[model samples]
Target: MNAPVDIAKMLQPRPVPAAMLDALKARFGERCSTAQAVREQHGRDESPFEVPPPEAVVFAESTTDVADAVKLASQYEVPVIAYGTGSSLEGHLLAVQGGISIDVSRMNQVLRINDEDLTVTVQPGVTRNQLNNAIRHTGLFFPIDPGADASIGGMAATRASGTNAVRYGTMRENVLALEVVTASGEVLRTGTRAKKSSAGYDLTRLMVGSEGTLGILTEVTVKLYPQPESVSAAICHFPSIDAAVKTTIAIIQLGVPIARCELLDANAVRYVNNHDKLSLRPAPMLLMEFHGSAAGVAEQAQTVQEVARDHGGEDFQWATTPEERTRLWTARHRAYFAGMSSNPGCRTVTTDTCVPISRLASCIDKAVTEADEAGLPYYIVGHVGDGNFHIAYMIDPGKPEQRVLAEQLNDQLVHHALSLEGTCTGEHGIGLHKQGFLVDEAGAATVEMMRLLKRALDPKNILNPGKIFAL
Candidate 1:
């Protein structure tokens, strides 16, 4: 087990002066809240850190509202954290340093849709499902899905990618432009509607995965795709997890262009079956989707089926109808909740490590072995087509030893991944949880450069202080 750092000592909240609170309340009237319930809601996220709530919450309804609140905080030299739907898993929304949370949930709006250019502009609070529904009539859809009905701004902040990312790419590739509120509350625009640019630094890309440390995203313009002419979904059972992973690597190696390739171990399948009230074989399985022309979809499916069969896949089934496909995916999307349902009142220490395609099998195998040896309740799921997987260890919140064991397992897994030239996190950003691993993965000099950049942009260190790296 790695030596544990003193997390409590690292998170010291700055004073939120009464004058700052008064200024915020005066500027926004009833929109600024100091209610304990609201502050508590804005202070925490899906992470398991125990920190003091922010002094207040500001529900921003527009870009101007966000700018004004940020400007006030900047004047007071207090920390500011941005909040969306609160779906982030890496503690991105936690009020580690006391200040205010700029809740952008009220800014949900699809400002413009350029169907001719296959682009859509939206406010920060617009969700993936909401965006797709808003543009459904135009036969266009946003393909980046992080599986939490996550807000676009939050997704951009984390540079999230999910099932469709294997073919369509992540927020880093899809986001074309951003309207950001800098630390001084200055609204800056980056990128243009044109497909490519070489005029200056790619500031849009910089803010996409900065995790609210650099700035707050107010508006986003993202690329969209035309609805496929033919779409097909399927499920194939494998004899073991290794066989399932092998099949996925083969599919990707062959350049099959599979839209979604997800893996579920027997534990995950059982949880989803009991929770979703559906009967599925309690075995390792691959849930896949292919999108293209009718003939192209057929060819892709056939190629995948052959690869799976060669690796001992069985019970090949297809969901041709829209309803059937929805049922399966909805269940998959709810797998995290299902896992929680099986172990009520349990806190999970989830690991997200992505490796090179050729190294994925060894990485996952070592993880499964380590987890089994630890004797903790756990489950496995992954976007295997892109070489990313999650192994969530469910531990009792009241038992300190259990958490220690889980963290030890996580540490071992992350080091193993780093040894294989993989990242500490695949989709989830480094908020409060993986700061130590970031140093190990990127080394001290690289992380120092990041700190320098943060200090340079936010001299006051008021924008999301104590995140990504220490100031």
Candidate 2:
């Protein structure tokens, strides 16, 4: 016998029962919102994709509040998705399931700064720049940067890496612990402030990149770095991009403990110099930073210069003043926007991937060649030390054939990464955009296990549905 379709049971506009609404109003008062504008705005983040509006938004102010809200959500059978600073590159915050978005921004408070232990405890909504600024006077700094001012929780959830990842590592290394609210409304503490442990499960790591599929992160304890005593910057130019990329590969193979190693292709250079109104070499370029004692930094800078010179790189230009370095990196960080500016009236499709350091030059060369052959407008750059880069292709979405060609090129790049024993995504998690590709990257059994975990934890299949996988 066929099961009843339940179309009428599910389709009748079942609004939130007044009892649940009353309970929420009691707890949050005006903080609970049903306003269409606010609900629709909370429904999505930075993803350039389609998503449905959420039913409501809750500005959570405490872990206890989070627990209470989740308990109610579980009882009411309403989905709950965690919201931090809406800055994910992937479509992580899309509310396809249509439920509640637990806005954690109200919980943005730095609770504890254990300078002795070199760790800090903070509400999940605390952003990288906000945390760093708070700790600046303490002679300690948090270094997990992701370009934008993303929340610590979001960064941890995505295993976000950025230009400084070459030195400090990603959220994988920085996050020491978490306070998570399980799907069943249970609060669990994972990991600890201790540096090393043989602790079972490594639940901390499991939660680090969960992306709200497994549980909701409420608070984070992160490791901190002692403020470097001295830092120096060096900018060098190469005759060609291949030469610049080759030099970066050599630096990594030679094992330089330098802080930052970023590459900006000639295209990126032209855009930034024009947009930011700064005079810079319109050639393949590498900007580096050395951190340590003055003597040690000077020596390392010299060593890097020698390596670059051997690969047809130019003289190393130094930027010692804070103003100089900031101006340089500010220009570097805006490289993506600059790429968009290269061609007026266009949108950017910023696709990212990582590879073994040895294969970077070849990978980038092939990708660039493919783009050139397709006659697409694009710019490419990355943290060369990590063998990860983004090719921001500018195209008119209205052009049907061009969109297809862009996706074709993207697929080719992903296959290239996989063939080289690298991941399809290095920093950006497998959100909706890369759902189909995750299986190819992790294999069927691995993806199945991931799905099984998702089902076991969120049996209702209400949390961020149709994301990463579909029924």
Q: All models: lDDT?
A: 0.92, 0.82
Q: Write the per-residue lDDT of candidate 1 for residues 1-471, one digit (tens) a residue.
A: 455444687678788898988898899999999999999999888776778889999999999999999999899899999999998887788777788999999999999999999999999999999999999999999999788999999999999999898999989999999999999999999999899999889999989999999999999999999999999999999999999999999999999999999999999999999999989999999999999999999999999999999999999999999999999999998988999999999988787999998999999999999989999999999999999999889999999899899889999999999999999999998888888999999999999999998998899998888889887
Q: Could you give candidate 2's per-residue lDDT for residues 288-329 as a string of tens digits?
A: 988989898988888899999999999578999999999998
Off by over 4 Å in 2: 1-23, 341-345
Q: Lowest-lDDT window of 10 residues in candidate 2?
A: 1-10
Among residues 3 or more apart in sequence or in different chains, the pairs in candidate 1 whose N, CA or C atoms overlap within 3 Å are none
Which window of ten consecutive residues has the lowest lDDT sum in model 1? 1-10
